[model samples]
Target: MTPAVTPAARPRQVRRTLPTEEARDLLELVRELIHKEIVPVADEEEAAARFPREVFRRLSGTGLLSLPYPQEYGGGGQPYQVYLQMLEELAAARLTVGLGVSVHTLACHALAGYGTAGQRAAHLPAMLGGGTLGAYCLSEPASGSDAAALRTRAVRDGDDWVLTGTKAWITHGGIADFYTVFARTGAPGPRGITAFLVPGDAPGLTAAAPERKMGLGGSPTAQVHLDGVRVPDARRIGAEGEGFAIALAALDSGRLGIAACAVGLAQAALDTALWFTAQRHQFGRPVLDFQGLRFMLADMATQIEAGRALYLAAARLRDTGEPFSRQAAMAKLFCTDTAMRVTTDAVQLMGGYGCTSDFPAERYMREAKVLQIVEGTNQIQRMVIARDLAGPPGR
Candidate 1:
């Protein structure tokens, strides 16, 4: 029951509706950058497991790294919707860059949304646009989904807080110039937590060897160990016990970023399938000419469009200052699930070739698996949605 539309002859040229000509121009610039700087080297860099620090620097220099933030702080002053669409474009080219940007944005969220005016004025310009990468440190070796249970501790000293613990599965872990760390300052659990902006090179702060991830190998994921790493009270984000609330608020926005990335990855997989099918001969004609394969591609495109719409709709809610936590959860859940399905189908459409490393289908499929797990798992998203719908389980 879906209408068929002609696919773009080239990927990353999908049609869009933007709020302003500025947004349209920004997207075009992103596509150009992705085509020139990201896509060509993506497979090779990922294969070599090389972290593209230079790519991030380029993104930062162009102001793409801080699009969703305010222009006064050296950002592009774009809306959430515009920023997310740009994420989609980057993700279609390479997940490392796209998700890396998302993680960096997540790292900045606490400071941007909850920091004192002095903190923002002092740090936002550099953090947003001064060619520095950032990591978010919420997860630990034990506490991932249950973030509030984090064991990292921050003890008050005369003029500083000494932090000690291990933060696990941190993107840009070893390479980031800064870290947004959540540490326990009082009793256990969420309310006892506090957020700190810790310099990456602070004394006794170190990163473990990068994890051997299933995909996005070009981006580093490592455990950051903080042993008596001292941070000034001036660096604390929000009140003494407001870190968990700040973190939750940040995640609400972060989920939408993940959703956009998922949609873009799906679009990439679908594009790959489209190109391969149209060229591969089956019997006397192209595989895409077959009814079954055609239908499969149709479904893939349909799913991609639906996912895009879902994320964009949630982003619009955020742009308009609405409570979008539930919508964010739904978009994250549906778009990531769609990415998994579409990437799997892309591989299926390519037959044995899809399973091989020579093509991108297998890689996209692998990357899709991670999306469902990050920014809170799909299971968590479902829980969030259910709680919004029927109140908490006890109620």
Candidate 2:
């Protein structure tokens, strides 16, 4: 994962209010890791397009990888609010690490949430704390946002199920130790899907070359081909045809992770802008002295603070076991949009320097854009929010 290459002076984040001392300590540990390990090598590794497998292993060992899971399952047992704050800090340092952690957590969701007791006992510990990596396989080349329309087929073959399909846009595709795969097992819609925990090394499982993307270069996004890969019945998560519900539930939480990452990225951009404006000379003084630029900076900071509060409120709702899907969607939508806007303004504030690779402003701007499209696209989030507000579309 690449580190934040904003400036010599690292950006200072606002102090957060935590519910417990342990949560507060966890955040401090994460910050230390970012400073000591991530921030230094981010630019070099990003330019090389290298994936930091070791960094994830370290995160796993530190309990950051499974913070929101239950303690009985070898997880950190922290609340979602605390877990998300950690994500934001990691993302501020580097998106590859932040998004990778989110994707891994999403990959573990199926088994942790819906797997039988026996399955959890068998898999949860290794997944949560054994330094193993995972990939979530739900989207396909043919299906992106329309998840229910996925065409991957899983056929029951005696005690094993043979899965055959290509999963697209999978983070950690080839590198993951396992995959949480959703495939069609019965009819042809959401009701037909089933979730399976497939070992990544299973026969006939392969990953195509990673896609060249506009940003987040250190994170690999690839198409995983499951060519008649076989998984035991023991690995199936939940009952048959219940995968869609599980996937939707996982996404509700996953959206919150994306929101936190967005806020972090925006904060990084804002910090870069702040640093640049203060140092860059204008007609007679620092550019930050100008009213127009100061106003822009003020607006950027306000949007970021608002986005953070929105996501945190949604997280609190989830922690209280209240309905939070609509709020999650709203947070994802607003936070990612805020990231895109703040990063763009950061680039604008830096003038010519921001446009160059010598500075991180342009890179931050590029990275901000993908947040708007990931988890659920901002457009999709709007649809979800609209559905919650007005009952579904023709109602």
Candidate 3:
């Protein structure tokens, strides 16, 4: 036999360490699941705008859906930092799935943070587990980013409240098992708003035709019509006049989820670009070999890495229970902008192929634009940051 040939040394495992091992393991599990289940069917589902209800059930079965809430409520009780990482990984593969998680988490927040003990005990288990999915109903035809202007009305009759209004751009509009609805219970201002948990099957509740969106088409977004929908007083979250505060706080946390998604999308674009550049030829050489092209790739990679760092820093602050609203806003603003830049560059790097549906760069570009708009517009994020720097609201 020929002299024993040593097998080529296996590539060294990077062994990147997160702040917590548990979080790292969770992220790895999410990545594995997305690659195996979500990625394979993403394109087809997106084309049809079909909500991946089964995939969500599978995610729930994995206990991924219940993270970031107390274990008593059937949640995984993981910290926000870990939860955000999972969101990042999911969004990187398919934004619809990522938004589903964010919407569910927001629903859970109303119950976990503000609900009465009876409400928590009654609804938390199903909501946190794979058995039920939840939606946030705050935006209306008159209010999108200006959520405080929602026109939904809730009038008390004896022990029951009759709700009437249309909530717009509701994720999981047609499929959610329950809705965390914010309706006017007092006068016509933020002080009048009150939060409620309305079952999906409640009489007089219906979802309009889903909105045709530029991206994230796999998630159903539509107007939720509540016509004479009745809810029990027991379902109210916190006291009256607390709705606006609760909504704002939930958004502070939600922004971080969007930022994480942006980071993942940018990373996907960078990875795809790198792979394409390595194989595509130009002028008798690989496109990646040219100095100009190489610099563009370098800049793209740097932006993605920087975006990741910013989101993680904000996440850490959140996990530690620090005042992280400004940090969260900053991360959302920066990461989304970076995603737009990197994905656009990715398309340019791939030349003709990137602009076509044969590749995902164009899709990635469309998705990146929505990130800048949702959770809160990038302009709103800047205002939040500036306000924080200027001190309190009155200051």
Candidate 4:
């Protein structure tokens, strides 16, 4: 067996205990790609609030976009554990890229997992292959975490379906090539919802201006309006009235993605804090030599490690086809909160420098805040875990 790279040998490397040689090789490739393509331009592109469409296309060309899905339909055929660890590395480099990949995976779930065989053959290739992007539409203006309360409606019009309503907080809202939309099709509540694959250029489908976010300005988040958008019956995923279940299922994996991204952000903050303290001298000694500051770095490192372990555990369960919802919720809640604390402390460690955009600590703190809110809020994650623990809301 070949020896793995050690901290002394690869100082800036993210040490991973991967399950396969292929996975390790893949990680190395990802890091090289980040250094060559992403890192040099991430700060500039983000500052300009420019989306990295070509970067995503390059990633798709590299097969990074389809890592966890089966390969027969143009995916990478890696396990979720491996795929999410890749996400962690990406997030450490840039949040917009990491979360964009996550949302794209979530968008493909409906068709990849439940679409008719014909549907998969027709669309999965382009979506998972390259040059095409997708968005998942579940939340609405009035329904963020109360996804079941969404007002989007899909009415039957003979052999076609007409979708109407707005989907809020949609990542890649305007730039996506397709949208996996869930809308009311039956009566009311979760059971009434049906999912559809709507083309981004469909008549009456439009995007509002992107939101001015606290961070991740490079990511285009906006409300996607489905104003009488029409699609063929063949576009509907799974059986009618199954959209809520599908959305929740997609969110389980999505939560783990957020958790992985959180760990990566926390890890990045810790790395910056370590480097900052080591180089700066106070009282004629490196600040890292001070016990108080040393303890802070220790705590930050411990929290990041714990978060990585928790999210990886959840991802492994997903790989094994086990009941992982509760674990996913726990990972999402704990990891995001850890990110918030660690990033804040990272800024404190760097003192005034950290608070400025010149350092990444302040930016990491802002980015961490959003992870706690998306993929179901931390509050909602608690609810999901509690419901899993004590049974459903009613029984």
Candidate 5:
């Protein structure tokens, strides 16, 4: 029987190990590239509300895009812990790029976990190699957090299945080369959902005009419209009614990705604030010289460190093949909340400068809010944790 551990003991039980030398070196390289490449053009892209496809291609060239899948399938095969760190580093540079990576990872998870041998053979290589980008289609206009209420329909007709629906808030709606779509296949609710791998060029598939967003402007978010898009039976990811389980499991891992992004954004905000505080004069000395301001900086650093610890702990649990769903939810909850706090404090430290695009702090603050909402809202995360603590739902 498994030993029972209290909530207080769980952190010690799920602590992370130090990263390998190779992982450290790769992360350092990623940071350097982000500073030199991504940061320089972030403002321009943000102002234009354009998705940087070329930049994604450049990232793909770095082999950073395929870090967590198997080498046999053209992936780098790095552990989830390492992959998440890379995500954190990327997000610290620019949230749009980080979100793009997370969406791609979700798409990869569906193919990796549920794809048939033939499907994997046909698609995994291109996806891992960056020749093909992917998107996840689960949410509809009517189905936000209640994904089970999705109105998308997939009807089996002989050898093909025709799909018709509108998938909203897709991260790479117009740009991805493929999409992992979930559609109604059974009764009503999650048990009826089915997963399919649809090529981007599939007939009758198009993207609606992109949504106007508060942030992540450089990443295009739009609705995907499927009008009788037909896919072969071979394209089905898993058995009918398995899509909900697959999507939830993939999200358990994806929440770790979002947590990493939050940590990175917090770190960026803190780093920017620290640099500015040291340079900006106040009362004939630097702002950092003030004890009151210094204390706030200390708090920001502490929270960011705690957030990192939580997400890394969850990632390690996942990498080790342990039961990490609860841990992942906890990390997502804590890290995103911590990020919101830290970024807000960072903005406060900057006074008027924080509210403008003259610096990135304002953008960081905006991005942090969205992180809390995505991959399941913080309220939903609390319910998940409470349910886990209460044991099984009907017990």
Candidate 6:
């Protein structure tokens, strides 16, 4: 008979290589915040299907709301690589919080990258300071992956643009302080789209009741209606017909953010599985002592590490001023798939206990499903990569 072999008493720590002392400190601060604040309340809040608005306010106060933007405009001025690591820590504790930060960053991208000096001076401060949360509005009732097919119209009315249409599947739809909206202003295709910045309190804008989802119910997802909402010309992020470009640019980075979140969720599930495998005993020995179960855990760890590497590499490319869209698509596609697999296996490893809310494995699995669908579905990601490989139209 074999003696029982136990898992190590403590949770295994992940090894990370930080670029600077400041980055190292930033990650430590984030972990402490997660441990003290988020981890304790995550399960309760998730179970009750309640949104944690105050938690975001607290994150803003802690300088975590805008870590990767310019410091002069009230951001933390951290590098993408470092910022992502902090996001990973946040996700491990509570995925809703981590993903919320990513969507906020996406909402700010157009104005930060293309707005005029006056626009930046007037608005970037509040946004990067974390005092305000923003939402991205691109998908319409008729358009999901087919962004160019959107019909939201914005007509120029002298000093203001009047918008009339509905945006669907918007994260932070009702709760955001502002919205980065894309609307059709000219012809029918991508060339006609324009991006605008609209206040949450705009006269003609309203959000529908939140969507009932499989998981991440703590975060709101809703449809926003624009009944002739009006905005001044100065609110436009770029030129009259540049919304498509802006949206794509933002997505390149947003995909990386999603990839990072996937890895973090997977990491959390893996950690839980590891802890359980070590603690639970079976047939005169620890279940983890069995080669089959041990190998399953090993594969989960390997998949997570590979996904992490892919996203980090894409981030590094963005940092170096390289064209990383293809790599970003690849990372998004691969990482999200890995997340689903890892989370499923994690639930499997723990047997019956994994399926209950008593363990996070089931929730992680549900959360992982949506990552593949957001920021353009993994199928769309494949289309993007294949287009790059095969060249444009007839090339």
CA lDDT scores, all candidates in order: 0.91, 0.92, 0.84, 0.90, 0.85, 0.89
lDDT of 1 at 146: 93
Per-residue C-alpha lDDT of model 3 across residues 80-158, encoded as one tens digit per residue? 8778878877877778888789888987887899888888999898898846888988888889878888899999999
Cα lDDT for residue 234, candidate 5: 91
Better of 1 and 2 by TM-score: 2
C-alpha displacement of 122 in model 4, angstroms?
0.8
Best by TM-score: 2
Question: How many residue pairs clash (N, CA or C atoms closer than 3 angstroms) in each of the candidate models, in the order given?
Answer: 0, 2, 0, 0, 0, 0
> Which portions of model 2 miss their true places by more than 4 Å?
1-8
Candidate 1's residue-wise lDDT over 285-341, tens digit each? 888889999899999999999999999999999999999999999999999999999
Q: What is the lDDT of candidate 6?
A: 0.89
RMSD per candidate (Å) reads 3.7, 2.7, 5.5, 4.7, 8.3, 2.8
Measured against the true structure, the TM-scores of the candidates, in listed sequence, are 0.97, 0.98, 0.93, 0.96, 0.93, 0.96
The parts of candidate 1 lying over 4 Å away from their true place are 1-12
Residue-level lDDT of model 4, residues 175-282, one tens digit each, is 999999999999879999999999989999999999999989999999999889999999999999999999999999989999999998888888878877777677
What's model 2's TM-score? 0.98
Q: Write the per-residue lDDT of candidate 5 for residues 1-395, one digit (tens) a residue.
A: 11122111000111225368777777777867776788777767777887878877877777788899888888878999899888887887778998899889888899898898888888898888865678999888999899999999999999999999999999899888999999998999889999999999999999998888888888888999999999999999999999999999999999999999998888888887876677677677888789999999999889888888898888888889999988999999999998899989988987887787777778888889988998799998988898889975788
Write the residue-wise lDDT of candidate 2 on 279-361 in tens digits: 88868788889999999999999999999999999999999999999999999999999999999999999887889887878
lDDT of candidate 3? 0.84
Candidate 2 RMSD to the correct structure: 2.7
State how far residue 86 of model 2 sits from its true place (Å).
0.5
